[model samples]
Target: MRHPTPDPPAPGQESVWDYPRPPRVEASDESVEVWVGGVRVASSTRTLRVLETSHPPTYYLPVDDVVPGALRPVDGATWCEFKGEAAYFDLVGGGTSAPRAAWSYPRPSRGFERLVGHVAVMPGAVDRCTVDGEVVVPQAGGFYGGWVTSRVVGPFKGEPGTWGW
Candidate 1:
């Protein structure tokens, strides 16, 4: 069964990027961008992820953030105990060597219902992540979250369950 957006760790929620993440909610009408291979792929003001590990919030850029035209559907899909089924994408129009460099869930489980339609591209797959034309420096593991250059909390996971992201 799904739980309510795990209330952010409370005011004293200790870690990094100190702040109550409120609750993983729906992406607003606004949109964020994800650029891989130095090319903008998609943009969507969608739901992002907030963890206690050691980094900043992971913004799940909506499929709208992606150029759509630049992505080619791939046969890669993964399931998460918390999130849901993820669909993969191939960076088709950019100089990136990755045929399938990003993934998302159009329909996510209730636990991760907020992530539906948002896309998170592998940071290692991109040169840099820029929000509103400003490049965002990653925290530790290079997982892009559109978080502007600043004090990051910790390292996010690259592959699922690898680092317990």
Candidate 2:
């Protein structure tokens, strides 16, 4: 699957888009703070950024830290050639014992191997999760954004396929 890149915001504007093709998903090995069930989940690792949006920015997290019994798989899904098929999950608990939240590719396309088995949750859904020790808010609904306290550009809003690709 190949998705074309939309034009970058004109020197000073911003655009959000998620298309297929050069799957650009990255992850970190470092442990990040993930608060679910209002308690911090230890060993939760990673920060991922997806390069496109119509809704909000998507953040990725490691499954280790998220409470094991928190997520309940749902039938929801969205598609993009870049990362591949995104299966959604409904948050079971609002971050306490088990916090179920939004997540993506366990089987991302070849280009998006970085996101394999990585889960991205809604910041709005959790009590707190910090990037570099700073708290963050989920950028988009049903998507994920890894503590986007400081970002250089914006095409913000994790809505897929927004900009003209």
- Structural similarity to truth (TM-score) of each candidate: 0.61, 0.61
Model 1 TM-score, 2 decimals: 0.61
lDDT of 2 by residue, 81-133 (tens): 56778887765445333333566787887777888767777677667767667
> Model 1: per-residue lDDT, tens digit, 1-165?
221222234443333434333334434343456666666666555446534333455556656656747767889688755467878877644566455567777788776676766676665466656544556655444443325333343333332443542
Collision count for each candidate, in order? 14, 26
Error of 1 at 122 (Å): 1.1
**Cα RMSD to the true fold for all candidates:** 6.9, 6.1
Candidate 2 lDDT score relative to the true structure: 0.57
The lDDT per prediction is 0.54, 0.57
Runs in model 2 deviating more than 4 A are 1-23, 29-31, 41-43, 46-48, 51-57, 93-100, 140-147, 151-165
